[model samples]
Target: MEAGKHDRGRSGASIPGRFVAEAGLTVPRTVLIVSPYFPPSNLACVHRARHLANHLPAAGWTPIILCVDDRFYEQDPDPLLGSLVSPELEIVRVPALHARMTRRFGIGDLSLRAWSALSSRAADLLSARRIDAVLITGSPFYPMLMSRWIEPKFGVPVVLDFQDPWVSAWGADQKPLSKAGLSHQLALRLEGPALRKARFVTSVSTRQNEELAARHSWLDASRMAALPIGGDPGDLDLLRAMPDIRRSRLDPAMINLSYVGTALPRSHGLFRVLFKGLAEMRARQPGLAARLRLHFIGTSNQANDSETFSILPLAEAEGVADLVAEIPRRLAYAEALGLMARSHGLLLVGSDEAHYTASKIYPALLTKRPYLSLFHRLSSAHALLAAAGGGIHFSFTDANGLAGLPQDIAAGLERLALDPASLGQPRQDHLEPFSARAIAGSYAAIFDGLR
Candidate 1:
């Protein structure tokens, strides 16, 4: 139970290691993981990756990470991801290639899109190393394209860990270079033969599993599985112990709703609607508006600047601009969870990019914090929260048929406040199952089935 000892000798009835032990899968099923963003990357996807990689060792599957060195990514390197690894788990950070490090955020075929060769070269390292299955986490689905080529040539099985549904799911939200677009079409066309040939496909949610199954009708469809992001029991305990935002709690009866991600542009962004709705609600319900305060817990850097998202002027216009507070990324994770423990609920904004997975919701579950989701109706994050057995969900289209907008949202908050089961009550089923050990166990099952 120290800093890195999340998995002591196996606990009973868990998924990740238990499944592996039951199947008699022993050390070194050998998985080579390709993640463009790894530890020190600090993006939320690595939480799940680190969790899965750390736990599967008990089942005897060795996970090796192949990631772009953080020096190459747009943000400063966060050394945290590497800390999540247990000594027994093998890991590798591929050195920076010419364009890969320089072209972190470029959207189209310009920089990030054209950097496939960089990943291709890095993937070749797998040949010298021992690897049984190729595992890939995507969203720079660009690198996984390299896996398609490398796995086939190297004779390794492939498992695509989809943090978000790629291609079609993004297409549903009208993303640039979509499955309908020529460039994305090219990636998919080249990827199809490689994709169909893979042993298994997995995801963080059923919404995405279904999206993949629909697009790849020729594949067995059942190969897709859901290994959701789970809360670390350690993080849960640590967060409950974290100091309350003393000033935030001092405000009389204020509802501290939290959002824990980077800001993005206005097109499909939920912060825009959230602020506007709060403004409208203020005009109608003075008490609720005045009682609400939003504490955002991720750095708003030059990269996710609010000016580009048009949040500044809109926020000012709504007279609720000051409600947005920024916290550093390093302290953000645990502090945000701590705030969720003390607050009435959490709030999430959709990114301009669709198929973007919001890691905010999972931690909310951990804290037993109910949340109000203001996302596009079809968003995987929204779908998961609505059906995940707790919380209130509202979408741009009233997609879940939750009545009217500001009125619907205001009423929803009132309902959450009134429900004896929701307010300040702990989550009976906290998200421990999504633990890395649990996830690695999930993969071991698929591995045993396929192997």
Candidate 2:
């Protein structure tokens, strides 16, 4: 069988009968989307795959999602997110192996344990149905490695979607072979074969695609594509239906600034600088600082862990503990969006890594609430915010260098709080390309081209 060729079934066609006629439309192809995170599991990794699974049918392709059973995730499931899945979509939930003993060695996740089950299930699906393409998305990057196993045996073209860099250099500046660095090294060795075998590679940002391409000369530039994980309208719909939860929680007199999402190791430096700047601002103008409430919702050092990490201690050390509210627990996706919408302003903090693109940017913009974005000047987020306008950009380092970082962030915060109108309305044209529906169209085009 050819790499892109599909075997014809008894009907003398390459597509399965189930996908043939849906609502009077002929769905010509089926793409198996394999990911550990999907609806009910509200991990950030789930959104892109969920969006594609939800919207792909409109583009002449039916998405059959292969995801881990809900028991695999430690986080509370968001049943509301399940509404995003189309009734026509086929979701295969495979049970994962979870041994609590393996966690100390960093091998607890279902991605590692479910490989055997995943591979078996995938092979069965390919044999039973005329799956036109296989798309594996990641963070639990091992799923991408399945391409090496699937492509050769089934002769299906696999497309690897990278939501985050597989081999990250986020904290490699000082310690070249740090724990993360060593993990990245292992990933580099494992990813080589899968990347080479993949029909095409898609990343959330252009910089990530270029970086991956540069690292692998065997990968053609044309084979790499940038597909951002834009916001889903369904998320907004659910959020809009919920009561104004923020009204009861937040002080009406204060200027509320909310940051929703986890704080990874790469973002420690940015948070340090932010807290210090907030402290300095408080010292300079205590009255103004009293009016500001910085809320960190769904922000934690680790997922599903109850322990509070460095952020709270750092805030205390910087003397802004009184001004900061740290909600270490993760919120439901809709609740988080509603919180962002109700805030006086939104806060976006990117990692020091140059390729870091805050996936939250789209939803943040969609909130229509003014945002203050702080990121490394070299990061993709910097360019995105600059291009979109309506947001204040504070560089991690300035002309005066690190010494001026605190003042710069402080000034940006003041501007965001005092002159909210200056941020203006986000241009809808700039946001259209990042919509989940629009992104699915791009993926459909790639799948079509490969066929």
Candidate 3:
């Protein structure tokens, strides 16, 4: 078969004219997407890969996903996510090294364990087919390292997608540990070669792109693109089908504000600042304070291991423990959206790190519920929320900004509680660039250029 043209099977159905036009030819270019987390894993990492795989077909590219087998995941699987995978798309699953073995050896993660298998499968696929390019998304940054192995063997261009920084500097909230610093140095040393070999790189924020470029002088600035994470339209449809669960859980008499998703280690300081601001607001206006409740869903202070990190201690220190409610376990994507839909307002919390953009921002904006965000002045989310313009933005790092945060949050809550409709709808035009379809197109452009 010719490149970009796959066999249509026994029926031999003719290729659609629109697909040919969109592709700028009769055949669609093939790009392999390597992600350690995909459908049924219910991981935040899966959404971007899922969105890319779902929309790339229309953009004149065929996505063949290579993901970890389901048996490797520790989290409960969400079968509904599998529905998003199109029948035409091909998925290849690689067996993962047993979690027990990985834990016992203290060697990286499941991605590291399955590296050999992944490398072998990816090589075989490339050797047998016409793969235009390879795109690898990271968190299990291990899979990205495979580019060094695959690129040299198959001679296919490689693109590295940074969902989060592979090596993050320890923040103020994080205790300075010698071991942690050493690990960061080791990861950077290992990551340097593969990154240098990549033809293109993409990150969720411009700050991250800048940081990576600054860290690696060999990296060409022209080859990097900032591609933000976006909400899946199908997820929105699922939310519409579910009844508003927020109303049932929230007290009608109280003004409810909610923050969804897990709290990262660097976010502890910001949460402390927010809870302190809330306490100050409560002291001045006891009536409003009495009627206010802050709900945290799918959040925990201690995310991994036996380490206990509960935000309740901070809430108690801020004297708002009674007003706080915590749900420590993560909910399914659809369930989280239902919680957002019923709440009067949404809360976005970001770390002091400039490159740290909350992945939840896009979905929260899509809910059209009024939102209040606290982020570092330098954070990409600060700029994004300001431009989006439907919500309040507070800079947590500045003393002046910090002083007014409580009042800002209070005013936002009052507005949402009294008249949510007054906050109006999110500017869908501003939201267009962050839509999954648009982001997929951006990736397609990169793939096409590389091809």
TM-score of each: 0.73, 0.88, 0.89
User: Model 3 TM-score?
Assistant: 0.89
Candidate with best lDDT? 2
Least lDDT summed over 10 consecutive residues: which range in candidate 1? 1-10
Instruction: Give one digit per residue, the lDDT tens place, for model 2 in 21-102.
Output: 5589865588999988787887888888888877887777878788777766666788777665665567777877664655
lDDT of 1 by residue, 1-451 (tens): 0111122222421223332332565434567666666666666666766776676667666666666555555555543334445555544544444455344543432125335434544456566765667777766565655555665687777777777655553444455555346555555565465466677877776666766676677867677787776655555755444555533532446666776665654332355556666766667767766666776655353334443334455567657887655553434344445666777667766653334456666666767666777666766666666656566777765423322466666566555544525534433443445555566677777876756
**Sort by TM-score, best first: what order?**
3, 2, 1
Q: lDDT for every model?
A: 0.58, 0.79, 0.77
Local error of candidate 2 at residue 25 (angstroms): 14
lDDT for each residue of candidate 3 in 205-239, tens digit (9 for 90 to 100): 99999988888988898999999888765677766
Q: What's the lDDT of the predicted structure labeled candidate 1? A: 0.58
Better of 2 and 3 by lDDT: 2
For candidate 3, what is the lDDT? Answer: 0.77
Model 2 RMSD to the real structure?
Answer: 5.5
Q: After superposition, which runs of candidate 1 have C-alpha atoms over 4 Å from their true positions?
A: 1-27, 80-82, 98-130, 168-188, 236-254, 262-277, 283-285, 297-307, 310-344, 349-357, 374-390, 393-403, 414-426, 430-433
